[model samples]
Target: MAKSVENQVEQTKVLPQYVAALVANLLVASVGCAMSWTSPTLLKMDSGETDIPASSDEKSWIGSLTPLGAVFSPFLAGYTADRWGRKTTLIATACPVIVGWVLIACAEPARSIPLIYVGRIIHGLCLGVAFTVIPMYCGEIAEDKVRGALGSFLQIFVSLGSLSQYAVGPYVSYLVLTIFSATVPFLFAVTMWFIPESPYQHVMAGEEQKALEALQWLRGTSVEAVKEELAIIKENVREKMENKSTPRDLISTKASVTALYLSMGLLGLQIFTGIDAILFYCQDIFAASGGDLDSSVSTIIVGMVMLLASACTPFIVESLGRRILLLISAAGMAVSLALIGTFFHLLNNNSDTSSIGWLPVVSLVIYMIVFSIGFGPVPWAVMGELFAPNVKSMASSIATSFCWFLAFLVTNFFPTISKELGSDYAFWIFGIFAVVAFVSVFFLLPETKGKSLQEIQAILGG
Candidate 1:
């Protein structure tokens, strides 16, 4: 018994697929850095620290540009992943991501607003591609038992990236931070080059031998040990690829349409939770609340809580299932947002709010904890799990692009809403939407724990 336990530990020490998942997500982390860069740096830009004259309106545009750019990359990413395979397409994204960061880095020296805007647009474009491909690649490579855990890694790395920026960006010079962020994707590309392609993609292209080899490596087993699994993968791919699916096919059948609606619905709920607005403007939110801790320090605390919660979600989802977690998350978020809105209302009224100055920080921390565990990650995982393989790439691209499009709207308008309509109303609107999200998840979402892809298809068919 001791010998068996020791061997299990030894096997885990060299998990090549886990290695592949982590390295690929390093690029996702870079996207997270791009997504939240404005959190710490936007204030400095408005102060003329970067020598780029960005007024409040320009700052809004700057914060919104990444999501805007992300909305466009899905079409190209879906095409590239289908054509060149997932590994190659992921590696190719690094160049534009690096270039985007470099443009922002150069903006400080040239004092050019256009350079920064161009750089943010480039970042958004790559953000869309990463969101489209990473979940599919991770889902394709993971074992059935470990799939939820592995799928959650995408969100974990994103939290890691956001935490890295939240912790470091406030303390470092803007140029230095952008330069450091640029290196993450380059490292992702170099490390990703050494990993094997997804066996599913290999099978789709009729490269059975290559698929066998790749599966063997990913499974940490001998060729014969993986052959049965390889055959299953081959059959599944063969079934999915019997004919290509068209755009109209996405809405043609009940099952396909159901999957699409559920996927898009979760994303919609997630967006209306005002997650992007909160993330992009986190520090500013704390600053406005007159918190006890320094705004930067409070922001770091929020980041830490978010990262820890995200890291815990893999295990939690495995044990509890996805739909329940979403239910819990939406309910918790509603209460937290209402608390924050109340605090802001008191502040806006010039009422004595010093006693509850802690409310915003506490409320945001709760909000982060809940959001990290469920809506932040589950929707992306479920999106990959829902579609038939032939339409998986295309459906994911549409859902991902739409997710970012909603993010663009929220982030771009959040500050304007806070300024023009009072921050209290902004928080209240998000709180109300959280209530709506709770209702939607309870009525519509399905449990996906421990199910095979074929089983999931059947469930959606019902």
Candidate 2:
């Protein structure tokens, strides 16, 4: 049995393969569709096209409840990912969103608002799982040469999915949109079975034979190379797992504690930068900015910019490196948001002469462009790169839970801030956060570009 395993590991490898990354992103794309589905669906319901017209409070609840559900998903998904393997957990998570789409499809015809809320919550759970698992899977499967590109797919497909909703949702029947959305997760589940499981997961489970097979499929390398990589992975996994990793052990090790703090801090900064808030209220921002474009058209424009920028990231992440891209993105976002806030301040103060009426649109486009290139995609990419194998699930769960919790807070509270202190204050506050994010990247964030997962852990002092 040992000789047979050695012979299998000694087989020549294939290089530059992407089956794992491609399939994982397909699933991530489904979560993206779920995230943005509420935007146009709510718009349609508020327009009274549905059997039951939704009240404003109901609309808010529907929009906010997604993050609420996300708060619990990490626990379920983290355990499942660690226990069942990343591929199975991802396939399982897809079931909830598929069911969510069905409920959404039925709600309008049946005149049941409660059903739609339930659907949103279910979709939220899908988001939580996708955020946790896809990055981990991609990080594990990708070779260093292609790792940056693979990692970037998590955000790229998300942009594409959101763009799809902006483009298609407004034009289709609510039922038709729901049906279309349902197809993504269904397809994701079917396609994922073909991809290799994460080598890290196999190593952690002490299935060295399975790990070698998975690495052969993923790395496409010589048996020697496969064995070499497997040795490193095994050593890392054995060292970490030997301690019987627990929640307390997560903070006990310096590496574990650092990984936890870095992941949580990046996620926090990602939200506080206010891109999610901007996305959530794109139409209202445009309406209040006195732009000549229709709100829907302007919103689509925003989504397109985000999509294009995200598409560029996979091509550039390796060349620019994570820290540089993050720095550039953060500085640009800070300036763009500050300019946008200034535009709103001028408009609010009755000082915006007609000449610069284009400022808001210009600033917002710039903001989204910069955000997509760096902050939008990079944080999750980094999260996947950090953490030891034994503590990954627990650490990821804690970090992901923090992300969803803060997302809920920001999405829930931004409206109140806008109402009480004015939108200018909210934008300015986000701008400040952007500046702080830049400083954090410069002073604290470690560069993970072109490094192996084990290498990243080593750099973290694991």
Candidate 3:
């Protein structure tokens, strides 16, 4: 027993796949940085920090257009991931982001709102593609023992990048911030070249030897051990191909229907909870709360809380299970958001809000922490695990696209909601959704922790 435990530890210590997952997720971090760009930059622009001044409507366009790009980019990502392979697809996704950053760097100095808008749209396209491709790639490449942890890397790095941006963006000039953002993807593209392609992608492309080599490299195991894992991957791939699924087939089958429902529900949970809109306008939300603290500093602190919370999941997910974490997350989010709303409710009513000025900041920090624990990362982590190999790309693309569409709606309209309906009401609406998320996870979400893709499918009745 001791020897076996020791060997397992030894195996874990050398798992190359985890490293590969980390490297790929650097690009995801770049996406996170890009997504959070509006938070500080918008504030600067509104204050006339830039050469070109933007109106309220133009700022909305800059903030919301990324999801618009997300709405359309997933089809391209899905096609490319399967046809060209995962490594190439990730490398390709960087191009648009890099270009977007370059445009932003130029646009900042020129005060060119048009260039900035175009840059934001292009980055949004990259964001959409990254969301679609990286989860699938990470899910395919990781061994079952470490899959949960590695898959969660997507969110960890995302949170890290977000924190990095939040910490730095407020203090930097617009051109410097844009230039810094552009450097991340350039680094990601260069580093990713050293990692192997997903073995699953190679298998799907009928390159058995290449698949084996990838498996060998990823597993860092003996040939025989690698072969056994490869056989399982190939068999799963073969079975999925035999049942080859389409958009039509996904609905024709009970398994696929369940998978789609779960995917969509999880994606919906991620957005409707108001994280994207809140993050996009973090400084504004803080400013509106009438807090004594500097809104920029508070936003940075919230970003730090999010980063720390996300960092905890990979270690605990397999033990505590997905359903419980998600339930806990949703419930916590509901409470925090409600408290935040109450804070605003009292303040708006001209109640003595001075003593309770701390409430909004504390509540938001709790909200960010809870959200980071589950909704922020788990949905994307679980996405690639839910579908069979044949339909994974297609289903994920659809779900990601849908997720972004909801994001576009929420982000574009949030200011309107907060203004006309009151910020308290906007938060209350998100709390209501959080409560619904709790119920949904309790009844519908199956635990995929520590399970293989085939096993997960069987659990979902696929």
Best of the candidates, lDDT: 1
List model 1 lDDT by residue over 1-462, tens digit each.
566545543453246778888988998999999988899898677555666677788889989999999999999987889799999999999999999998898888797878889999999988888887887898889876666677788788888888888898888888889988988998999999989999989988889899988987887876766777788898788777786789998987778999999999899889989899988988889888987888889999999999999989877766787888898999999999999999999998999987887889999999999999888888877777788777877788788888999999999999999999999999999999999988988888777877888888888888
Write out the backbone clash pairs for model 3.
52-111
Q: All candidates' TM-scores? A: 0.92, 0.85, 0.90
User: Residues 287-404, candidate 3, lDDT per residue (tens digit)?
Assistant: 8887989988899899988888888877766567778878988999999999999988998888999998888889989898788877877787677678776777678788889999
Q: Which ten residues in a row have the lowest lDDT in candidate 2?
A: 8-17
lDDT of 2 by residue, 243-322 (tens): 55678878876777788888889889999998767766666677677766766677789889988888887777656888
TM-score of 2: 0.85
The CA lDDT of each predicted structure is: 0.86, 0.80, 0.85
Ranking by TM-score: 1, 3, 2
Consecutive 10-residue window with the lowest summed lDDT within model 1: 5-14
Report residue 264 deviation for candidate 2 (angstroms): 2.4
Error of 1 at 52 (Å): 1.9
Candidates sorted by lDDT, descending order? 1, 3, 2
Whole-model lDDT, model 2? 0.80
Candidate 1 vs 3: which has more TM-score: 1
